[model samples]
Target: MNTTTLASTTRLNPVSRPLPVLLAMEDDAEDVGRLSPDDRLTCHVHGRWIHQCVASPLHVNPITRHRWCRSCATALTVSVDELSGAVTMSCPRCGHGASAASARLIVACRASLVAARRGSGARAA
Candidate 1:
């Protein structure tokens, strides 16, 4: 019987090992704005997209016209239905509409969602 250590096994099949691919930082300004809405690659505000900046969920306040959920008094999560292209913001706890300022945000979110679905199909091909 023979026993091989985990480290030894890794060394024997280096080519079979999966390599971690890091996303390169985008530098071209022209390409940055060209990103589709659903493209999480770059943020509209920041020149480069940082996960923390773009990934954080949004909230909305009807009275204040700000990002806040007054019914639940907490931040709201934005949900996108990829199939129907419907973007909605609601109180996570109470299921109430949080803000009237959602019109612009909703439009942007819908466009992004649709773009993402289309992009995925292209990549698969």
Candidate 2:
């Protein structure tokens, strides 16, 4: 997507910004991997409250593993840099940082997950 289109598709609605940097510092980079079942919930959390993307309602958050949106599946792949411990959500279809909003979303979602797991009480199952 072009910058304008991407901007419209993904706005700057970052609910959690600084937390991602903190997570990068605290967690090992190798700890992050392909999205797992828990990571599915992370996407859900981001879709509903953070990004408000329309495609989110159609997403399937199954218990068996992590899921990606059609767009995310097609254009992006999320990974963690082992040396820095930073969760890097990159778009293979595009170039590095091609999707800044997506990168921010990943960071925000991961941060929120860490907070929720650490007793932030943002949501509960």
Candidate 3:
């Protein structure tokens, strides 16, 4: 038989593989505290991660009324430098500095981003 035919036959008649019990259980387990600051956890006034959500496009501080990039009028994109553990948000259009709110959010999410990167490393599964 040709290589293609053999491959198709193997796919059609799939081999039965044993399911991993531990993995299945772990999948069912609730992921508490898995959400980072950037996640869609809703705030009463701001809605879901309003300060960080890309869909929002503009973040207005309720208290200060400060906008991320006044000149560009565009929302800042969050970037995490995993190597340096430095988090920064900058305007996608003009590369403007972050506003007061954006700066605070960057500082808050830096540790979380670093932790996430470290946890993403290959582990014995």
Candidate 4:
């Protein structure tokens, strides 16, 4: 990865969740804002579903350009800027960058994002 891409890629902690689940969980209904108690529960359930979906391995083939995680069945699109050493993954819902090894860290960040959204949403609602 180029320095710029590397810089853009968020560094994850040593232990963290997977990215998609984190993202989905972060944006759960309650976090999005103005949800009722039932909506909050529904959102939590949805997030749990997403978490299960992200807890598996992804498959990739260099020759076929076929890459996807078995759990979520989401397509994997990667962008590498040769000049800048930036490697980004356009996740199903959002785009974030980091070295492959940083995947765990990215996931952790997403969890935090979910917490942030929930906090803000609670205040807004």
Candidate 5:
């Protein structure tokens, strides 16, 4: 998308100004692979909540094992509570998907949940 499209979408209401960092991330250098999942949650991209997109194939990392279950050879399942904003990442096969990356992601997801619910200025398009 061009600058024009991005400019239009970041507008939450007529009187509001766009936040410096919460704008669209579609042009974010292709999926923001290097960006932390938590930071990805704070930005408006894909028009979905953090929990909605956290389990995407893009998040799977076999080498670093960010969300990988080495023994099961599968990506971990993500569960998030909407009201309570609880995030869970467990292997679907053996329930052994725990890692430093997943822990960081969980924290980010919870914070994102809070922001999504409380911040009127950071709505996704």
Candidate 6:
């Protein structure tokens, strides 16, 4: 696994609740004290929802081509439709920037968006 892809940028501390639980319990932008709003199901940084804020420049990765169009040298644009649960990342110049990392990010965004809208996030036992 590439550590860079999933690395989290957040303040650290010991927290008892697992990730799913925290994601479910905390509302949008709620810090939950220890964890950043940027959970695994949310984002890699920016401490924001996957669907809400993926346009950050930090999301671009040239090596992994996550949100970068190497040939065009452009950061791919993110499109997410909460109502339809659709998510996509593509380069505006050429419309071709699919990548493994971006695919994973898309899946995460779709799940997070669906769960947030439906209030179906996993609950702790």
The residue ranges of model 5 lying beyond 4 angstroms of the native Cα positions read 1-21, 24-39, 43-47, 121-125
lDDT of 2: 0.35
- Give the CA lDDT, 0 to 100, for residue 27 in model 1: 24
**What do the candidate models score in CA lDDT, each in turn?**
0.42, 0.35, 0.40, 0.35, 0.60, 0.61
Error of 1 at 53 (Å): 8.4
lDDT of 2 at 106: 59
Model 6 alpha-carbon miss at residue 62, Å: 1.3
Kindly report which residue pairs in candidate 5 clash with one another: none
Q: Report the lDDT tens digits of candidate 6 across residue range 1-125.
A: 22322213221322344344534444433433433323345553554566777767877788878788888988999988877888989999999977777887776677566545443433332
- Displacement of residue 80 (Cα, Å) in model 6 is 0.9
TM-score of 5: 0.62
Minimum summed lDDT over a 10-residue window in model 4 is located at: 1-10
TM-score of each: 0.42, 0.31, 0.38, 0.22, 0.62, 0.61
Show how many residue pairs clash in every candidate, following the order shown. 4, 0, 0, 7, 0, 0
Once fitted onto the true fold, the runs of candidate 6 whose alpha carbons sit more than 4 angstroms away are: 1-39, 120-125
Tell me how many residue pairs clash in candidate 1.
4
Q: Give the winner by lDDT.
A: 6
Candidate 3 stretches greater than 4 Å from native? 1-67, 114-125
The local lDDT score (0 to 100) that residue 81 gets in candidate 5 is: 87
User: Candidate 3 lDDT (Cα, whole model)?
Assistant: 0.40
Q: Summing lDDT over every window of 10 consecutive residues in candidate 1, give the lowest-scoring window.
A: 17-26
Question: Per-residue lDDT of 8-86 in model 3, one digit per residue for the tens?
Answer: 2222454321123212222233133323322222222332222224234344443442336777765556665657766
Give per-residue CA lDDT, model 2, range 8-66, as digits (tens): 21223322323344233223321443232222213333423222231343333322112
Better of 1 and 2 by TM-score: 1
